[model samples]
Structure formats: C-alpha cells, structure tokens
Target: MVNLFSHNISNSNAINNIYNIIYDYASLISGVLSIIGCSLNLFLLYILIRDKQFHTVSYKLIRISVISDILSSFTIGTGCLLISYEFTYDGGIILCRVVIFFTFTSNGVSILNLCLIAIDRYFAIVKPFYRRYHRRRKQIFYLSQIFVWTIS
Candidate 1:
C-alpha cells in the first residue's frame, strides 16, 4: 500500500492508484505488521496451550516469549491505531515513561528468553558431561524465568 503511493511520482515504476483516503505510510505499515505479528503469536500461543506435546519446561519459556511478543505487538498496534485515526493524544511525561518502560521491558524479556534457550542448547551440544552432571530441576528454570521478568 505504501509502495502504491509512490514518493517519486515521476518514476516509471510508480503505479497510478486512485484513492480518496490518504494514509500515513509508516503508521499503516506498523499497524499492519503489528496485526500480523499479534495474530501469529496468538496462533502459536493457542497451539502451545492446547497441545499436550508442547507442555514442557522449554515450551513454557517459549510460551513466555510468545506472551511478551503479543504484549509488544499490542503496544505498537495501539499507538499505530491511534495515529491512523488521527487521535491528538500527545500523552505527557508519565504516560510516555510508562509506555517506554513496558516496551523496553517486553523487548528485554524476549532477548533474555532467547539467551536462555541459546545457553541451554550450547550446553547440551558442547558439554554433554557437564550438563549431565549439573542437571537442573524444573524449579530452577521457573526461578530463572521469574528472575528474567523481574530484571527486565
């Protein structure tokens, strides 16, 4: 859709599209991506919640990651929707701080989730003996997740 509204009007590759509504390309793209991302995450969350096969410690972490993704998507989507609708909401300092905090926290949680998964995979692959000897209980992973959330 953004491509359809060519910035370079004189360019040969531009398509002559006719429309009454003018859209902000950035907002539209962000909103579209947010919807798509939220949908995919919701689907994956559903599968994880419903399927017995996905009920494992590792999958629990994945589920948490998916949740964070959903949260971040919603945050972005909310802003985009407001902008697209031309809402004159210039939220002051407190609102801005809260929004920024949540965004960064969710993003940090996701990165930490990946880091946990990577470390687990690395241990399993590189030092099987070490991992076998230091086999942690499910409580450890659960605690780690809690820690990750709190720290994030």
Candidate 2:
C-alpha cells in the first residue's frame, strides 16, 4: 500500500511538471508572436497614415483591421504574458470584464475587416462596373466600418 501510494504521488507530480513546462512554452511563444504581430501592424499603420496615396477605401479598411490587431495583441497578448509569469491582475472583476470585452471585440472587428476586404476584392474582380461605382462611394467603406464596430 505504501509503495502504491508513493508511486501515484510521483506520477501525479511528473504529470504536473510536464503540464507546467508545456504551458510555459506555449505562453512564451504566443507572447513573442503577439509582440511581433503588433509591431508589424503598427508599422503598416504608420505607412498608411503617412502616405496620402494610401488614403483609399481599401487602405482605410486595412487601417481599421490593423487597429483591431493591435488592440488584440495588447490585451490578450499581455494577459498571456502575465499568466506565463505567474502574475495576477488583482484589478477586480471590472478589469477582468473589460479585458474580456476588448479582446473579443477586437477579434470580431478583425474578422469583419477581412470580410470587407474579400467583398471589395470580389466587386473589383467579378464586377468591375460595380467596383467603379464603389470607388465613388467611399462612404460605403466607412459605413461598413461603423457597422462592424456596432456589431462588435
């Protein structure tokens, strides 16, 4: 009975150790990637904002997408990093709710932006006349963005 109990305890400890290692590595990789992603997105946003030539509907959509990406990276990515470091927020339930809200909203916005891009491409390629019409209606893109935010 003593040997059995000792063996079970050792096995449980080993399993826990393995789990910790995996979680640590996963969190580290996710945090690093998120930082890289946010950096690249910010660079792209800067270029878009600096260049007047990029002030088109598509570019606007891209800018919105990048903004959402940055938000996600900052909120979710930072949370993951904190967890990996065994740090707790202790900022109460409101902070937790805010984090969750921003993370999900940003993710939703990102997805919606992609859908807008795809629709724009479809009109450009599959319906060239409609694409020309779209070019004159820049408000459409802005409206779509607003709609996305509203939904998110």
Candidate 2 shows a clash count of 0
* Candidate 2 whole-model C-alpha lDDT, 0 to 1: 0.83
lDDT of 2 by residue, 1-152 (tens): 99999999999999999999999999888888888888988998899999999887777888898898889877766766766876445753545576689989998998899899888888888888875666666777868888999999
Poorest 10 consecutive residues by lDDT, candidate 1: 12-21
lDDT of 1 by residue, 1-152 (tens): 67766756645333433221345667788888998999999999999999999986668889999999899888777666656664435553444566567789999999999888777667667876884425674666878899999999
Global lDDT of each model? 0.77, 0.83
Off by over 4 Å in 1: 1-23, 89-98, 126-135
What TM-score does prediction 1 earn? 0.71
RMSD over all Cα atoms, model 2: 3.3
Q: After superposition, how far is residue 77 of candidate 2 from its true place, in Å?
A: 1.8
Instruction: Give the range where candidate 2 is weakest over 10 consecutive residues by summed lDDT.
Output: 87-96
| Index of the highest-TM-score prediction | 2
